[model samples]
Target chain A: MRVLLAAAVVVTLITADLHFNKLSTARSLLDAAATPLYWLADLPARLGDWSEAQVQTRASLLEENERLHRESLVLQGRSLQMASLQAENVRLRALLNSSALVRDDVLVAELVGVSPDPARHQLLLNKGASDEVFVGQPLIDADGLLGQVVQVSASTSRALLITDATHSVPVQVNRNGVRAIAEGTGALGTLEIHHVAATTDIAVGDLLVTSGLGGRFPVGYPVAVVSEVERDPGQPFARIAARPSAALDRSRHVLLVFIADAQPKE
Target chain B: MDDSGYGYPVVLLTFLFAAVLAILPLPQWLMWGRPEWVALVLIYWVIALPQRVGIATALLLGIGLDVLEGAVLGQNAFSLTVVALLALVLYQRVRVYGLAQQAAIVFVLVGINQLICQWVQNLQGVGARSALFLLPAVSSALLWPVVLHLLRGLRRYYQVS
Candidate 1:
């Protein structure tokens, strides 16, 4: 009788969670309550980081600082050009009467934990709704687009990586602006572009970027680079695969993008 | 059964430790081999004290795990309730068995737990493509004796009756 009661409760909870948004508040509250568990679980990694910092050689640190200083000099030179280019682009947009583009703001969040299940490509970030991190917010790393926030609690949020089996992003080829949807293939390094015509201009080595059609991700962020293209006379659509630009498995810090127009109106 | 409930705190602490281990980050290759820590801990408690730890305790722990994993609220709850029921029914016979035989039973129990979780994930269309999801069951079975000894020591130390 107790087993049946527990089973019934499980069925009801699963149904409510799957079919309705009513459980989201409860879920967030649970996440908030479990915050300390995540912190405790992350203790080993934090200790490792602390020990590494403590054990780093002075000469090596100096060498790294020198390299960063040189890199920053080059980046500063580029930013000067970017400032003029941005002003020129704004003027061009005004002449064309197109809506002005607003710069996206980002908040850096450290990875607190990873999804324990290997099948799920999700990340737990230190930022949450309290940090104004909301569901559907796009995440990026230094190299390219990473993922999007899927769940937010008080001080922690979960983001689904673009390489997750269920995730898909709208992208365009940088070479020609041809649009395609890049679907995650459940592998960290690979994404599949489905339903492309065999005659399409896509080829191996084409750069895929966000097209901004979905309104979920900001425009023109690097997503992936085509790695393979297979065409067969018998099949109507070509098979294409790309490598994700972001270091999905390696990045320790990710940026949550806040676009001016992408905020939830609620 | 101990009506004083003096052992409940110790039981809760063990579960909390298992929860911590369950979410500890592991390298990519080791992820599939990560043992089902919470399930093993729940099984231990159920076997140790059937009266104090049963389906209700399993259900609550499973919900906590679901929250920790950001899974659908009841996914682990369903699987763990079934595990608790099986453990409760078999604990009498299991108490007299050798460690090897107990480990075998644990393999079966954790395997069933993995299957239920996989089934739930499959319904949501995010299930693993390979049978590697069952690898945790094997790892959990291999670690059963160690966990059993350590937890037994802790239980005896606390005089958990």
Candidate 2:
């Protein structure tokens, strides 16, 4: 009788969670309780990072500093050009009577841990609701699009990666302005573009950028590059696969993009 | 029953340690084979002290794990409760077995636990990539003997009920 009762309760909880998402608050509270455990578990990695920092030779440090200075100079020059380009873009939009593009605000967040489950591609970020992070906020690394925030707790948030099997991003071909949806294939290296016409002109090496169609991701971030384009005669649509643009497996720091419409006004 | 007063903390502290290990991140290649540390610990407690640790304890710990891993609520709880109950029922027989034989039973127990979790995930349309989801069960079973010996030592050292 006790076993039966426990099973019934488990079934009820599962049904409620799957259909209604009734346990999100409970999950968050539980997350709060488990935060210290996460911190403790992260100690080894943190210690390794600390020791690595401690052991860096002065010559190597000086070289790194010089490289950074050189990189910053190049970035500064590009930003000056970007300012002029933005002014020109605004003038052109005004001439065409189109709305100006919304500027994106970004917050730097450190990757504290990753989801232990292999089936899910998620990263736990150190910043959360206290930092005003909301669901569906876009995350990016230094190079390109990463993913978006999915679950937010008090002090942490989970961002789904673009390579998760269930995740899809709207992208446009940088060369020809052709649009397609790149769906993750449960593997980090590949994304599939289904249902494109075989006659479509998308070619290998074509760069893909976010289309910003669903208003989920901001427009014009690099997403992926076409790697394979197969035209199957038996199928009406061609199958295309692409490699992600960002260093999805390497980067440790990510930026959360807060768009104008997504943030609540103070 | 003299040590019953100290039993709860022993159970909780071991669980806390297991909780940390269960969610510790592994490299991409090794992640599939990461042991189910929390389940192994829970089974150990259920078999060692069935009167003190039972289905309720497993349920709570399972919920804690679900939240830790961001899995669906009650998924681990359901699997863990079933495993705990099975361990409790077989405690006498399992307690008498040699460590190797006991590990075989643990392999089956954790395999069942993994299968239940996989079933729940599939039901929600979140299919695992392949049969590799059972890899953790194998790894957990392999770890059982060591974990059991260590925990037994800790239990004796601490004089836990």
Best by lDDT: 1
Give the docking tier of candidate 2: medium
lDDT of 2 by residue, A86-135 (tens): 99999999999998997999999988778888877888889988999888
Alpha-carbon local distance difference test for all models: 0.93, 0.88
Please give the C-alpha DockQ score of model 2: 0.72
TM-scores for all candidates?
0.97, 0.96
Off by over 4 Å in 2: A263-266
Binned by DockQ into CAPRI classes (incorrect, acceptable, medium, high), candidate 1 is high
lDDT tens string, model 2, B1-161?
Answer: 46535756877988999988987867789988999999999999888888888998888887888888878888999999999999999999999999889999999999999999999887766668789999988999899989998999988888777
- lDDT per residue (tens digit) for residues B1-161 in model 1: 43776667999999999999999999999999999999999999999999889999999999999999988789999999999999999999999999999999999999999999999888777898899999999999999999999999999999887
